[model samples]
Structures are given as structure tokens and as C-alpha cells.
Target: MASCTNWAAHKLVHAWLLAALLVTLLTLSPSLSAPACGVLATVEHPVEAGRPLRLLVVGDWGRKGRYNQSRVAQQMGKVAEAMNNIDFVVSTGDNFLDDGLASVDDRAFHESFVDVYTAESLRKQWYLVLGNHDYRGDVLAQIDPALRSIDSRFFCMRSFVVKAGTVDFFFVDTTPFQLKYWTDPGEDHYDWREVAPREAYIEHLLETRRYNYLDTLGIRLNSGSATELTWKVAVGHHTMRSVSAHGDTQELLQLLLPVLKDNGVDLYINGHDHCLEHISSRDSPIQYLTSGAGSKAWRGIFQPNEDKLEFFYDGQGFMSLEVDAGLAHAVFYDIDGQALHNRSLSKSNRQHVDQAPSLVSQE
Candidate 1:
């Protein structure tokens, strides 16, 4: 009877110890207990005072060089070579295809990403977000810091900010905002480990507190008396306004668009429809750009929305942006290394002056 009593006491002690350990972990890492959207990691990419910040944006790409992904990459390399000093590349999302990485050791990472974008100019840092397809596989594997060991250029997170000179790029995680992913995800299984109770997660991510840092940065810039023009660009995997097959993501239009408009976001860039597009907002000055044609493209999928469609190309292509203190210019390039359309916006004293987009002749 004494031995039994001692064993019971020992088991109870172990239980208490385990509970304490869990509490300690939660205390040490608040992220384990709850998502803290305000604490997103910021990556700084400095630019020279007089030079304009240049970058190439691609999405819906990773397919092991298949589906004309390699061809598009070749054109991207050519464009980067012409620019000569491309800063970095922004991958809107869907880094992997139908599903995401099965594991950190998945060969698709090398076959699709490493072996594919093989250009001297394409060796710069890559900032990426997670698409809905990414959630279908090991979501943790893609964002795992360990993957950096394989390629230092790989920098991805749930949602983060990249501050480059006058532009502050806000990369948002938009997959969780969709209701169908949780309620009607037909045979597909999404790895929503850290993002359960979607409402709280979305609320925290879109909270104004998360954007206070940008406001502070703006104040600092304005303190110099030289009327510095600050630009805010938001990137995500889902589209707010599009004329392609996927059209508009209603979830983002309702929940995320208002916050972006309120925060003075100048451009919302996304990739999901596997086509290149540009749409102008009627209510706000915000411009919507899509560069999802990194791989396969829809040939004849067109669905008009309420907004003004500036440009639309139902073929494989990518987009490039060059931003300075006053002017921001964007160009869309097709798989044949031809410029299809171009647009420019000039700002003075913090007011945007929109320029009409012109079609580039294929000659």
C-alpha cells in the first residue's frame, strides 16, 4: 500500500512538472499562445539616395520548369540584365504548384526554384508569401528558417514588411480570410496549425496597431522638411480586383481592402488568376496589379468586374516596378520577352497624379 501511494505521488508530481513546462513555454514565446501580428519581422533593403528601387514580381510559378515557367524565367533574366542593378524579387505566392512542399527536404524546392531561376541577375534575395496551395501541404516547411541553410536567398514568412527607401512593402497572409477554405474545402486538406479561429487571426493581422510602425516611419521621413514622398505597397496571394478566371477574392475585398485603403496603400499586388492584369479603383487612388502568369495561363478566361480594367493579358508573363521618391512605373512583359503594357504614377506633395496606361507594340 505504501509503494502504491508513493507511485501515485510520483505520477502527480510529473503531471505538475509537465503543466509548468507548458506554461513556461507559453510565457517565453507569446507566439505559441497567440498570434501577435504587430511583431512581424521587418527586413531592410537599403537603396542609394538618388537611385530608384527596382524589382521583378512573379507568382503562381513553381512547377519544376514546366508549363513555360522556364521561358518566363528566361525573360525575367533578360529584363534583369537590362536593368543591371535589380534590387530583389518579390514572389506574390503559390511558390509551389497544386500542393506545397511535402517536407523541407522535398526535391521540388531545388528542381522548381533553385534549378529554374538560374541567372546571374536572379541571384538576389527573394521575398515570398504563402498562397492557398502552399497551405495544402506542409505550411511549416516553407516558412521554416532551416530552409535558409540551403539557399540564403529564400526569405518567406506568414506576413512581414520590407522597407526599401521610400517604399514600404507590406506582404499579407490572405489565405485565412477566405471562408470556403474552412467550410467547403472539398478533398483538399489545409494545414491551419497556427491559424485556427480565423477571425481572431485576421483581426490581429489587420489591426491598426500593426501599421503604427509605418506611420512612425512616415513621421520621421517628413521631419527632414524635404516633403519626402512615402509609398505603401501591399502584396498578397489573393486578388482584390481582377478580370481573370479567379476574378476578385470577395474575402479580401470585404475584410482586407478597407484596411489597406484606410492606411493609404498606393498599390495592391497579387497573384492567383494565372494572368497579368491591372485594375484601377473608382473609389480610391489605389491601383491593383496582378503578375500571376509565371507558369500556366488561362487562354480565354475573362470576367469583367466593376472597376476599370487598365490592362489584361491571358498569357504567361510577369511585371516589374521601378519606384523613386516621386514617380512609380510598372511594365508587363510576356513570355517572348516583349513588353505588353506599361503605366506610370507621379506624386507631388503626397498627392498621386495618375497616368493613362499605354499598350506597347510587339514590333
Candidate 2:
């Protein structure tokens, strides 16, 4: 039985296939992997000071509303405008509410993302990570197109090293491993409470290897970026240490921090705690930030021995990070452009030695 729609689809598909075959036959050559679009804008400290590489980091903001998401976007755009430009944007996760908007294709993407992020300069550099909400919602297809359309180079659950002048950033996908949830056969979302009717487990399937941050991406982490590079940062969608109703994320921290510390990662940016807190690790200068204020204006509650916190704020805003070699500066602002928090990190051992002989001294 050949249905009219099926016949029509078949003819269309056949025509496309014929064209592909013809092209292939005419061009008998090997194919190459898609070129890796360099992750967000990367550069080193020695870059021209006249033009600083600017970036805004925000997360958990897919829900479109007034108190937070809307206000935050407005303020972020204002800052980007003042600077005359922006390099890229990083999202820690929770791109949407409840269940990641049914799918990445949901109308919410336009309202929450497209409308809010109308800054033309920002379109090219948006790095996104899947939050728990995205996982719960069946948005695999929708998510891909939205992100790709936004920034084809935008990555999810993958690692891409970006060189900001002289620093390297290794971004990871921590949400998938945090916990696996399943939805019923026809459900668009997984119930946080009830497990899916059918549950199956696949062991050692690569991405599931939580510690792979040190294994697969290990090379990137241990690249001796030490002194050659001014700074190295690790970004994810979950928190390492936070004090809020959402509380501390011990499971993720325990598994991830050691790798970061050992790899000379100076800063950790994440979104999930729904607040902002820049904490200094007692054992290390590595900075931990919580900027889950995309839609959630949740407050922060300092933890025990939390004095290392240089700045903490609960506002609807995003963080603008500037890194120059070993020195990095961060400012979190409110909807009115008022600075809510500011923090900076400089390498105590700041020196530039020519590791590559093929270099010329600017001086």
C-alpha cells in the first residue's frame, strides 16, 4: 500500500539521494570530519589591551520571567553594549524550567533565548550545557537545532579547549553523569519522583565514565598549561561548593575537583545553585562561582569556614569575565548595571617564557 504522502516523500528522498550519488561519483574523494569551530573566542594575556576578550557566564535561565531572567538578560546586554562588543557566553545549565521545555525546539527557546539574547554580537559565541531539566525533557532533537542555529560551534556534553589569549578552557558535560532519569514511553518529561517504568543500565559506555574528565580530557587538563598559559578554567553545569536550599553538591565535587586542582585549573564556573557566590578554596586559590540566576533569584547561605568568599550576591544578573594571561577579573552586576560582586585571581608565579622558539618579542 503506497500512501500519497509516503509516495511523495519517497520521490523527494529518491531525488535527494540521486543528487548525492551524482555528486559523490563526480567528486571521488575522501571526506573529512567537520571542522571543529574553535570554542568561544580564545586568546592569551599578551593580546592587545585595547580590546579585551569579554565573556558573560550565566545558567539556569531558560525560564522567561520578569524578576530574574528578563532582568538579567537586559543588564547583560547593556554591559555588552557598553564594552562595544562581546566574545561569547557560557551557560552552566538549567536552560529551561521544570523539564527543559519539552524539547529544545519548544517555543520557549525563542521566548527565553532568542528574545532575551537579541544582542547581534553575541550570536556567534554561545556555549551551552544541558541541565537536569533538559535531560528530563525529551529535547534531544530540538536542543541540537536551537544550539546549532545559535552557534554551530556551541557544544554540549563535550570538551572543547578555547584559548583566551594565553589561557585554555576545558568545558565538560557533568549533567548526564550526575544522575540518569527516564520518562514513560509517551511522556515528554521524566518525573523527578517516579522512576521510568522500564529501567536499564549500560556500564562503561564512555561518556558515562564520570572521571573521564581526568581520563579522556586528561590530556587537555595536564597540558602543562602551568606557566606557558596565563590561566586555565573548567566549566560545567553543577556546583562544586554552595550553600542554599539546593545545598552542596558533594557527589559531583568529590569526583571532579581533584582533577581540576591537579590540572592547575584556576577557576570553576557553574550554574545550578540559583544564586551567586565566589568562594576561594581554602586549600587552593582556585575560585568557585555560583551564577544560577538566569531565572532563579535564590539567595545564598554561607557555609562553615566560608570566609574565603570574597564576594557573594543574589541578584538577576550575569558575570563578565576578563582574563589576561595569569590575571583574571570577574564582575557580577544587577539589572540596573550596579555591580553586585567582584573578584579577581592572579597567578602568583606570573612569567612568560617562550616555550615555542618560533616567537618574536613584541618589545
Candidate 3:
């Protein structure tokens, strides 16, 4: 019986090794520079004394080929191995490059996502949102609903409120305002309506308003008693304020920042511009973090008036946050989890602040 068990273990090892080799081969291929891997990160940290909820947050990922997207996946695997409590992943949009999810079961999403975050825990749940790219690609609803059917944990267009000790999480989708194909209107070949609903420039501005900032905060505050543990976090993909090519998410910020200040949401996490940044908004004391360096890194634009900007780097890497009562911490690293930069948020500071995270190229 022992020998039979040993044989099974050996087969499993061989299968994993084969998978690794396949990934490496894809990475080495010149044509498939990006190949296929999960651009979303996988991490584990016990936020409280209860169930550990490790979250993988990313944006502007899914380039299938081109850049170091595969390296990001390899590094995230290391993070998964280090923690036992991680159960799910979340993203801010731009799930695929250019735009759209392939057909519902198209192997691309899984190949790029599922296989990349191949960790047992990461496969558990994946909550997604729209990015301008998704709108350009096609109706993401088709794939989103199907993924949920396969696993109820894919909380697309849904809210996730889970507690890990003292911390409360508000996982949100921030893809509505992402302008589809605006990055390059010339390359678009399909009807604009195919992806996101067609909205005139002005109407789009009003319709694609950022999430009602105060409303979400109010929901959170109301969801949990004022006496509930203090660490409250809000996350999405677009930047509330930044100097990157994406510019500042002004409208969204106007609605959200004031509320974040009023409610004291601990941290603002996003990944629209692909870089590593921990910016403190002069507008408020909130800490804004950008960890979208999964597949590629974008060059950052530093501004002189950017008050309270703590740290910013256009490097290739990922981030892991360790929160357990009392303190909430963040560590940014290369694909391997090596410490690049670090910071912690006071219980009061984390509740709310205005300011944010990303740049697209590392050049």
C-alpha cells in the first residue's frame, strides 16, 4: 500500500514538473512572449484569528504573449506555497489584453488565469470586474456567469465581505469608466457596442461614473456595527488619483474620496497603471497602493506637487499584505516575494484617505 501511495505521489510530481516545463517553454518562445499564465497574483496571510483570506489583486493583465507576464505567475506560485490560508483572488479589470473574454469556455482565461494561479487555494474563488479592455474584447458577462456556474466563488459584479480576524474587506469592481479602445481607437475592428454599451462622450462621462464612493462606504459601515473591528479596506482597479498616463480617476475620486475620509476606510488598493506604488493622498491621509506588475510594468510619471506620495516604482513584481488585528502591512516584491518596499497602516489611517496606484511600461 505504501508503494502504491508512493507511485501516486510520483505521478503527481511528474505532472507538476511537466506543467512547469510547459510554462517555461512558453516563456522562452519568441512569438508567445507572454505565452499563458495567471496575471492575477496569489498570496496568503492570516488577517485575523479566523479564516485566512489571501487576496490576489491585479489590473491590466492577460496579455497572453509579450512581456514578462509568465514570470509574474511563477513568482505568485511561490507566494501560494508560503501561506496555507489563501482562498481567493480579486482584480480591478483589464483581464485580457486588447479586450474581452474569449468564448465562455475558451481555454485562454483558464490557461492565462487558472493554470497560472495553479495553487490549490487560488483556484478556489476568483471575483472579477470589467476593464476598458474587457469592453473592447466583448461581453464579459458570457464568461463571468459561466465561471460562476463552474464555481460559485467567482463573485463577478458582486460584493465580498469576509472577516479575517479584525479586518473587513470590500472587494469591488471598478471597470465601468475604463474607456474601451480609447487607448488606440485605430486598431478597433468591431462595433464599439460589442464590448461596453455605447455611450456618447458626454453621456459616457455621466453613465460611467465611478462607484458611488460614499454609498459603498456607508454600506460597509452599516454592514458592520461601528464597534466591529477597525481595519476596513476598499479595492478596485482604477486609480483615484495619479500622474500616470491613465491620469487621475477624478470623478470616481470626487464621489469616493470624501466618503473614504468620512468613514475612515483603511486603504485604497488599485492597479490601473502597471507599477508598484504606495501613495498617500495629500487630500486625505489614506494610503493608496498599486500592485499591478503581474505581466508587465509601466513607466511612472512623478510629479512635484504630488504631496504625501510615499513610494513609487515601475518595476516588475507583485505585492503581499499581512494583516492581523492591530496592524495592516504591505510588502512589495519582485515575482519571487523578496522584499522590495514595505509599510504599515494604523487602524485609524487605514479606514479612509484619498490618493492611489500604476504605470504601464517599465521603460
Q: Which digits, one per residue and each the tens of the lDDT, describe model 3 over residues 1-363?
A: 234335334323222112222323322213212211211111122343454345556566677734677777666656655655455566666677665665677666666665565556566555565555665554434234456564455444323344445565555545444444444467654323322332333242345322222343455555534444457777777777655556577656765567677776767777777777777777665778877776767575654336466667776777767655555567676765566666766564343323222111112
Off by over 4 Å in 1: 1-37, 199-228, 349-363
List the global CA lDDT of all models. Answer: 0.77, 0.58, 0.54
- 60: Cα error in model 1, Å: 0.2
Would you give me the overall lDDT of model 3?
0.54
User: Which consecutive 10 residues in model 2 have the weakest lDDT in total?
Assistant: 32-41
Please list the residue runs of candidate 2 whose C-alpha ends up more than 4 Å from where it truly belongs after superposition: 1-50, 142-147, 150-159, 179-213, 224-227, 299-307, 350-363
**Candidate 1, overall lDDT?**
0.77
Query: TM-score of every model?
Result: 0.82, 0.72, 0.69
Residues 269-347 of candidate 1: C-alpha lDDT, one tens digit per residue:
9998899998989888889999999998866988899999989999999998988888888899999979888888875
Compared with the true structure, what per-residue lDDT tens digits does model 2 show for residues 250-361?
Answer: 6566666777877777888888777777777887767888778777674645454443666666656777787665556677776676766665556655322222211111
> At residue 167, what lDDT does model 3 achieve?
60
Clashing pairs in 1: none
